[model samples]
Target: MPTDTVRYGMISTAKIGINAHIPAAVKSHNSEIVAICSRFDGPAKQAAEENGIGRWYGSYEELLADPDIDAVVNPLPNSMHHEWTIKAAEAGKHILCEKPIAVTMDEVREMTAAAEANGVLLVEAFTHRLNPHMRRARQLVGEGAVGDVRHFEAVLAFTSRDTSTDVRLKPELAGGGLWDAGCYSVSAARFILGGEPVRAAGFAADSGNYGVDTSFSGLLEFPGGAIAHMRSSVEQPGTNMGEVIGTKGKIRIPHLFEEDTPLVITNADGEERVETFAGEPRFVVQFNDFSECVLTGKAPEFPPEDGLANTAAVLALYASASSGQITAVERV
Candidate 1:
């Protein structure tokens, strides 16, 4: 609330916030993470102290009630996303929520509407889109670098050996490989295509223990017949990467969301080129961008509307697997 500061309060000292978000905020010129809230006080205080945050609250409500904090970042579970996001919006704080904004389309709509009605900026934290390479990739794709944009392919996977229970493996918590890693693939395809998917067909990986998907593979059809094939899994190990193939040429973005994106672009003239950003912390870009929107009252380029659209697509894919038929993605 001060003239020289953008005060942020994080709802949880989750792994993401501790390792990335908090540090990023500390490094940003315009932002300072002044408060932190967690269900348990230990991690909250520890993170706040380690990151040089000014205060730590024992509960989310306490952080939300802080008059000095201008923005709240929600890094809670997928199921908790809608609740906290709406709560933040209602409290008159701009929100930068983690993606897959909600597990269901209905909640996504409600959260989006709440942010709009409250006149507070709400943006899903799709850090990939904030990467300078992705920004340029979109521009090149639109300029016919990828010619008609016929198809796209993306994959996100990692191997976790932890036996400890996590929300990613819990259905009730909106956990699943699809809801977790799969959301990234879906969001990436949707981001590159620049439109909502009209339909989806997919298969879920049922490992028998969890009733939810452990892995998923799917195809999405965009408005102009542009199609995408995507795969995500928790039982696998690999780098996170994605590529967009258009009619004339294709672009490949390696280490897609992390810092220092190297973009390979090919044109119809049989020439290939690579572009790289100087180097930035991906999470820093996300925090700085969100802070700007909160301070200036500007709508986010990757707004809550994106959360709704991606949820619709992922939900449609789930439905297709459950019903054994192609399911239509509800337009956002």
Candidate 2:
């Protein structure tokens, strides 16, 4: 705990944990993956060995009980997020949880309460928001480059590589395009808008007869006459992009989640320019940010409250999709 780097114990060998968090932690200057835990012994050991981590545990309890691990990286399934995150917080270790923080608002609140009670830091891993280009795009909006936000467009769509065993397609695991991919679009919108949405309306499609939604188009009405249109799908693969349309100008964000996607700004006078950013990967930025907060004992730049609001917004949209009615987002 006295060192400059945070020793992170990854909670699962899920794709996010293995594909993103582990690599990012290894690349980060302020964070290191000292250990990884999975209920399965083979995966935990394999991932640890493959990633050059020092230790691996078959059970989460054993990993959490270790005194060497300073924090936990939780990329568990959406439904399991609440339980595992609360457990980590209760164990007095900081947590970096994946997006769509929990299945319901109550669960997010409960997890937040547990972290607060235990005096541990809990951060939601929003890769889109942490993307450097997205940060610059937000700055441009704040500087009036977009000129009075009017409407926003965002989409994250992809066809499932394997529908047979992918956990993202299973309803019991809270799998859906909206929860899996749409959350990024939702987060991008809220990040740029800097305001909580008041109303939400959505329509979901269950292609391939998957029993759960495979694609969805959602609408969020924010204050001051600004609105955001978000689309996400696992059945339709296309460009994942964003655009901020304002009264006087518009910014075209090609691929909002990518690391080096250029931002095109078109002003009212028909001037166009492309801006690119140079920095670490989105995942790396996220890990280092979390580690910085842990080391400095400062509140995270985007705290659990932001996660609560984002989850509330996504839930409102999903609710509207199910009921075929306009749902009101909880004002957080």
Candidate 3:
């Protein structure tokens, strides 16, 4: 492991890694993708050839054995995140795992513990939080531009062509709208509120094929009387939107998750303002941040504990949806 650059071994050739993380790593000055692995050799070889990577492994363990690699990017399936992250930590490699780091808090705790014990950094890869527009929104709200945040609403949805074949529709794999897309809304709401919800209540409708929730709508109650409404679905037209309403004003984000766009702010006196942010590739920002954290031995801006908080909230929402009652989010 060289201190000058973070050599990365990619855990899978998933679409997110191929389309986002790999490109971002290439563009980053402090990191490089040295190896890539897949369950089979052909896809790994293809990804390595196409991306100009030097090594390809048919199994993840082979990639982990490379002493020259300093970090690993775990873009594996949701169910695999906890397992691979712990393995990477044990291998003495810092990790950048995908969002909703785990389906449950127990897994989150175990992953965090493993990383801490191994003296490695483990960061949840939530690209939206790294977006300049998102930072600006948080800044404005923090500055009281929203006049003491009272409520938040977020919605994210996209239609899947084949629910039967998609991993997102598999219940055993921790797949569903809430785990897949809704986690964004829950995370965003938590970020804006800057606190965990005390109680959660929700409803979900399962897809007939796999018994995975195709649609989920939930409410979160924060300690300060602030409320958050979140909705997500895999059976609807694509939509991404969020709003933070306060005593004196409100801020609206048109594309909350997928893109950088204008943020609209409206005051009680009928004054409206539009704020535009300089566009930068979000994945680039994410990769750079992870590299900086790993190299400097600094905790990630959004640490593993934050992922635990978000997962706790999501779990509470699921509990509420299941029991038809408000569920309290357990503090970890």
Error of 1 at 308 (Å): 1.1
lDDT of 2 by residue, 1-332 (tens): 95699999999898988888888887899999899988989999998889899899999999999999889988888889999999999899999998778879999999999999999999888888877788888998888887889999899998899999877888888999999989988889889878889999999998877777898999999888888999999988576999999988999988887788899999999999998876779899988889899999878988899999999999999999989999999877
lDDT assessment of candidate 1: 0.83
Candidate 1 residues 203-300, lDDT tens each? Answer: 99867577778789999999888998889888787768888888888898887776687898877786889987865787887777777777776667
Q: How well does candidate 1 match the true structure, expressed as C-alpha RMSD?
A: 1.8
In candidate 3, position 254 carries an lDDT of: 91
Task: Tell me the deviation in Å of residue 295 in model 3.
Answer: 1.2
Against the reference, the lDDT scores of all candidates come to: 0.83, 0.89, 0.89
Clashes of each: 0, 0, 0
* Candidate 3 off by > 4 Å: none
| lDDT score, candidate 1, position 147 | 78
